[model samples]
Target: MKLRTLLIAALLAMPAAVTHAAEPIEGNWKTASGATAAIAKCGGGFCITLKTGKHAGKRIGQMNGAGTDYSGSITDPETDKTYSGSGTVTGSSLRMKGCVLAVLCKSQTWTRL
Candidate 1:
């Protein structure tokens, strides 16, 4: 009886372990505007930064630099606008959508680079 209980407990733990696997954002990505986006884990979540491109003739990069925690608004180089939202990693893709001032302003699909 004790052995059976232990076996069942072990089995239950396996699923939780599997679900804790790293998210899909730990990689490089390409934005729609011919720019690069480097994604990695940040503050127990995920953050994406511009690796290369130009915004107002200045080299566009992450506001907090590399490996910084992201919370709140993020600027999109393509549209040149700041969006407020979050993202999720799904099967080699990071889907991010944000609103500008309570309006569903933009969304983007970034492929693994």
Candidate 2:
């Protein structure tokens, strides 16, 4: 009976152990340019790929870290220029900033979709 109880307890805990919770940065977002971008797990980090507009199917960003903060590179699909970028996730919004030389920086708030 003890062995059976242990097996039952383990079975009950299996879902909690095997299920992976998504990070705050994982989701589809509406970019400042009005394009839909999908952020998902890729290798060691997250890959941001555009899903709409002229830049559809383009991978424009990569970020590392979990929870509400991330750092990586972001590319401007219009200009094809890459910049150092960081992101902050708050509620349903993600504020993304890109910089040139770490002095000139621009930011945009993306809404989760």
Q: What is residue 93's positional error in candidate 1, in angstroms? A: 2.2
Clashing pairs in 1: none
Cα lDDT tens digits for candidate 2, 15-48: 9976788999999999998999999999999999
Any idea how many clashes model 2 has? 0
Off by over 4 Å in 2: 1-11, 14-19
**Per-residue alpha-carbon lDDT of model 1 for 1-113, expressed as tens digits?**
99999999999999999887654556677766767777656664555667777743332223222222233556756666666755555666756667777676676777887
lDDT for each candidate structure: 0.61, 0.96
For residue 52, give model 1's deviation from the true position in Å: 1.8
Native RMSD of candidate 2 (Å): 3.0
Candidate 2, clashing residue pairs? none
Q: Kindly give the stretch of ten consecutive residues in candidate 2 with the minimal lDDT sum.
A: 14-23
Give per-residue lDDT, candidate 1, residue 93. 71
TM-score of each: 0.55, 0.86
